[model samples]
Target: MTMINEPAHTLPVLGEYDVAVAGGGPAGFAAAISAAREGAKTVIIEQTGMIGGIATAGLMSHWAGSAASSVLQELYKRSTVPDIVEKFPWQGTINPEKLKFVMFEMLHEANVHVLLYTFVSGAVKEGTTLKGLIIENKSGRQAVLAKTVIDATGDGDAAARAGAEFVKGREGDGKMQPVTIMFKVAGVDYSRAVFPGGFEANLDVPKGKIQDLSRQALPFPAGHTLLYPSSLPGIVTVNMTNFIGIDGTNADDLAKAEYECRKQMDPIVKFLRDTVPGFEQCFIISTASLLGVRETRHFVGEYTLNEDDILASRVFDDWVVLRAKFNFDIHNIDGPGLDKNGAQKHFPNVDGYSIPYRSLLPKTVDGLILAGRCISGTHKAHSNYRVMPICAAMGEAAGIAASIAAKEKIAPRKVGVKKIQDVLIARGVKP
Candidate 1:
């Protein structure tokens, strides 16, 4: 690799605030809105035109893992069909279109300064502490100064740029999970639709592999045509079309994944119509504007969680997320198919686990909070707590902690778990 040197220049300050949140996804949404509600002047910068990141942009509207927080409750209440998940197999579902607007309305109500179509160019750092973020948008490159920073950028973009110690992919191989392109199909016959635990498929699996997959009740030739229904009738979500070995944070890999995933749509829809019973009339209604990248930079934090903690459903003294639940839904980075404890140890029951606040505090950085999939955890553990609901819950905690730290003139780690827990309990977040 070669480098080119450019003259250094000072950037104009975009604004100053108590808390500056990078990324406006589910986690960022909760983080920014919750921070504002905590009496902190907060600003949230998003890379896309909309606020809801993967949930809305990636079109993966299914909400699994843990109970809904107050923010999620309000979001679901204002949705077009609040009870969309009444019959859905998943824990919850959302109308992605309506979800976007609800987040916008909620952010506005919380008085969070929203910056859309903005990218975090770099992290503004003061030693190990992040002072703010350097953002680039239509206006041009600028700086956002803040007392505290929340790294909800999903990929840990801001934190990584700030020299935070983090891990990428598996420890040895550096192979991360595959990227998915979620699409929607219309004219589905729900009564005849066979949702074998979130999947529909074509008649193309090898006999021996089919038997192996059937033992686990996993869709044969799985990771090909999984179906998650939408709130509106006749429209169903397709969670298949996996591109293995694609690094989400890599630009070249992402571009390739998007193109390849989109190209799989025609075949996938055809497979549904030609093979599946209820999807005989199904057609491609729309494809997501973004690709759903599962795993990325996992910033090493105060306490790195592991599979044993999740498997044993361990609770911590500084628990931030109360009773989080999700399987180790790890996609094969070296091959195809989902790896859910088959290669590792299977969780014995459906018991939920707790995530500590310590996991959200980056070990080497001050004045910064970690949220979403990027928080401290091993590759296997990341697969467990990387779901939407848990991410939102983590974001909620991050916001409250960040605000308290900013107001009290302390680092996020010093905000104390008791203070954050009290706030969460008062907000009706049931354990």
Candidate 2:
């Protein structure tokens, strides 16, 4: 590594807000809207042109669970495609474009300020409390002051920059789950396609068969491949192709992963066109603008949710959010670990578990809270709660807590759990 010195210059200070959200993804969106609706002067900063992070930009067109929370339920209802609602409780395939529109509308109605095409480059902190954030955009560097900050970046970017203790990847070697680039193909014949259980059925193919097919098609490593029908007819989204041993947080590794994933796309499309029943005429429409990163940075919070908590379906006294009814889905760090078998650890008897408010409060950071997949949790626990629906729920809880903290002029950690719980329950979050 090398370093270069540049002349120091003061950055322009942007307006202050009661609550500042650092990401525009599912968690950020929910946090901003929830805060604003609670009468807090909130601002949501996004690096992209539009909101809806992975769902819109990453091209993940499916919502894995049903209407668990009011905010999620509203998003499902506003989806342009009606069929998504029909699938309820199972899996809902959404129209990404529609989702972007719906999010914008919701934010507008809540009167939340939005800053698009802006990235949080650093944070200004006084000890454990974040006083402001440094942002960079086309307009150059600037700063935004806030009473409380919500880290919904999905990577704990703000928390990490604020000097919060964090961990990345699995326990032993710090190896993370492989990243995938989703692609869409058009000209599929849905009628001829054999989707026994649904579109995700493509992922259920046997591992041996997947390996055999990958070898026959090309030299690319055999991993998991999944295809799901899109909102539009004659089109399908592919969740195949995995780039192993790539560190998502490293710039060099991310660049390499992107290049390698893109190179593997052609062969995958060809494999589908030649062998698949309905994709004979299908061609690559577009690949995701961003790589689908499974795990990156997990912040250390007041309490770390672990594998035992998930398996036992633990309930917290200071419950602040809800997660979808799913399993501990830890993807293999090396190759196609759980992708072949589907990374699901089912809790058949339970609906879902409650995430304690303490998990969102960083252990050492005062005036800051974490949301999305980056919240305090062990690798196994994160696998279950990292999905979009659950992330949104966590964001909603963080927003409510942040707003209350701002109103009372107290640190986020001092906000009462009972206050947050009452508001969440009223907002349609189940206890």
Candidate 3:
């Protein structure tokens, strides 16, 4: 490693806000909108020009979680993100382009400030308290002061930069989930394709030479691919390529993944066209602007979620997210294969499980709230909560908690969990 001295320089304060959110993904969008609606002077910063991180930017247009659950059920009731397209009658697929605008309009209606094309490179901290965020953009380096900060960055960027305790990947080899470059293909024949009832289907024809990625009872099933119907007829979004052995948090590894995953596009299209029934005339259309990096930094919080909690359909008294029905899904950390246990399709309980508020509070940091996949949870649990629908619920809770903390002039961790719970219940969640 090499070290160099950089001269001290003053940074302009961008603006002071009651609540500031980093990463304008699903979690950030919900967090900012909820906070602003609660009368907090909130501002959300996103690294890209567009909001909706994985859903829009990453081109992963599929929505997870059932309509029988909390905020998601309300969204379903209100038709918030319209079922513009459906692979099946109830697959929950969406049009990403439309979703980006929908999220933006919601934030605008809430009067929340949005700063696009900005990166949160660092943070301002006093003792163990996160005071503000250090951001960089075309304008130059600056600061955004805030009373309550929410780390909806998905990668725990703000919390990690503020010296919050965190861990990356799973134990042992410390390998995270594989990254994919989602691409769309056209000229598919609906009648000819296997057309699995759900949005996701693993076509046996596209299976390359299979290996025992997981040598357990599964023996690693064929087809490391997942295809979902696009909003348009004869078009499908393919999440097939898996660039394993790359770290999402490392710049060099991410760069390599972007290059490698893009390279998988043409060959995969050819494979589908050459063998699959519906994709015989299909051709590659577009690759995602961003790689779909599933797992990254998981921040240590007051209580960690685990696989058993999800399996038992557990609920907590201090629960924030209710009836989170997404399965305990995880990709193979060291191989280009799907975790057979991914998306527990046949869970008995329709009531689902709850995500505890304690999991959103970073154990070692004050004035900070966690949301999205990076919240305190095991790798498997993180996979379940990482989906867009569930992430939005967690973000809403974080937003409500943050706004209350800002109004009361208290740290986010010090806010009464019951108050947050009551707000969620009033909003139609039974927590």
Model 2: residues with Cα > 4 Å off, grouped in runs: 83-91, 195-219, 337-342, 345-350
TM-score of 1: 0.91
lDDT of 3 by residue, 52-109 (tens): 8897898875677742234445344333343434344443676777667877777778
> Candidate 2: lDDT of 112?
88
For every candidate structure, what is the RMSD over all alpha carbons to the true structure, in angstroms? 3.6, 3.0, 3.8
CA deviation > 4 Å runs, candidate 3: 67-88, 196-223, 340-343, 346-350
- Clashing residue pairs found in predicted model 2: 327-345
Model 2 TM-score?
0.92
Clashing residue pairs, candidate 1? Answer: none
Report the CA-based lDDT of candidate 3 relative to the real structure: 0.79
Number of the top candidate by TM-score?
2
Ranking by TM-score: 2, 1, 3
Highest lDDT scorer: 1
Return model 3's CA RMSD, one decimal. 3.8
